[model samples]
Target: MTRRTFLRAACAAAVPASLGLPALAQPAAWPARPVRVIVPFGAGSGNDIVARLMGDHLGRALGQPIVVDNRVGANGSIGADAVARSAPDGYTLFVTTNTTQAANPALMKKLNYDPIKDFAPIGRIANTPAMLVVNPSLPVRNLQELITLAKSRPGKLTYASGSAGTLVPAAMLTHMAGIDMLHVPYKTIPPALNDVVAGQVDMMFTDMATGMPQVKGGKVRAIGVSSLQPVASLPDVPPIAATIKGFELLAWYAMYAPAGTPTPIIERLSRELQAAVNHPGLRERLASLGLQPVSSTPQELADFSRSELARWGQLIRSAGIEPE
Candidate 1:
């Protein structure tokens, strides 16, 4: 080769080495720093617990600290909106439930974020079945007895709801059984469950994770499971559909990122999240807490969210629930 050509090549090679740049100037991999997982409920909530558990696993997998931020308000809209408006750089993620994406659109008339438009779904993490539990002093042993008692007293009995999961199911029970029970809403599930345990409220459709401990502790009586089939965690509890046919409800948790996030980053997050939930150790831990571990692809979660929105909307209207 000519001396000038050789000199040109040598300079080109030395420039990259002197600058400490890679031979190929590629972009840095995602999750270059600590990641934030936003949970739209108070601490000690079922969603919060699940997020922390999976966050630990995910953080280890990604080799970064995973921060769980609880931004509780407006039935989860505040945190969700924060994520929706965030930059689509894969650092901020939403760990939420059906309450935000499915029931909120039906339960509230004005939402600051579009469930379908403003976010990209990573994948579903788990399905959390709720239990119908009443205060030990309520004098009801089964679902049938509770319905009968509510019918006899009309609006005298009250039930507490902390999220759309509990609220919609309670309303569905009231409508299907043709009974009237006053609705009491709380800011989070633990406080609502406490009220039920204290006999301040008659009953509630409590998430199994938060309610099972109370039931096993003899603080409350579990009458039925909201799922169509009995869950393994609460095998003795009969399915509510056995008495009130077609009565089935469940709250699911999933991961989401702000819209416009790159497809590759979205896919990587979905894979890591699914792996975290499906880990054998994590699955066992979740099962003991009455949460069934489940995972879905981005497209699958997107489609499921759409269907749940419609289903909850119809149920809300049928239950005579006016949007706030």
Candidate 2:
């Protein structure tokens, strides 16, 4: 090669490093700009709370701003599909609960996105419990009393549900307890809970994040928890298992990117997320949201998600819930 041509090539190769830029062969660093986190549920929901908390931590960890975009409707399918169709670039992230990832498949007759096929798992965030609440005027103080009243007045009582987290538990209770109540569905929990508070609905199952404050404020009466074990926030409230044997359900939060996101970016996100959740005071704040914080690798989340999908399907079927 001529000296001028060789010098030019050498200079070009050296310029990238001298200017601190990636070479022609190297891709630019992931997330060179702000990252967008899509929360499938509405604002004030458990999913949104976790998304904002982790989004802040992740943004700080990655030196980028986290923008939360709420895409609400159709039991979180719209947002889940949005994420599924987004570019597999690291900038688009999904912070959502089992409603979209695990339960939607069994609850909905048709979906535009595949829970397992269309996304890459980032990590598991937390395990959330649901609380069964009734309006204070309902006169039923406990799960057994409520069941008896429903049986005596079958089809007269109504229950509101906004997400699978609330819907499945209530359905399971009715099926197991051999009671009947009119079903009232809403687009989200806030409205469902609001109707319950207004005595428009008799009762509803809601996540602790949204229901706990109302329970504390005396707006709603806590009947029983979904989990077999009592939640720390409401130690006195009995578990639904206490009334009906062998009933347990928990909603979960996790992160995901569209399928085909590079593995390196996935691993980096897993590490950063784990570190962020464990950072001082973050766990406590998350706990206040009724989250039991947990961490997992990408593979672990994938496996867990698969298992949860099956489990949720079975739970829905056993509850005699027909897919809408």
Clash numbers, per candidate: 0, 0
User: Tens-digit lDDT track for model 2 on 1-324?
Assistant: 999999999999998788774344577778799999999988888788889989889988999999999999999999999999999988899999899999999999999999999999999988988999999999899998999899999899999998999999999988999998999999888889999999999999998888988999999999899888988768999999998999899999999999999899999999999997787688888787667889998999999999999999999999999998
Against the hidden true structure, what lDDT does model 2 obtain?
0.91
**Global fold similarity of model 2 (TM-score):** 0.92
The estimated TM-scores of all candidates read 0.91, 0.92
Error of 1 at 200 (Å): 1.3
Clashing pairs in 1: none
The alpha-carbon RMSD values of the candidates against the true structure, listed in the order shown, are 3.7, 3.5
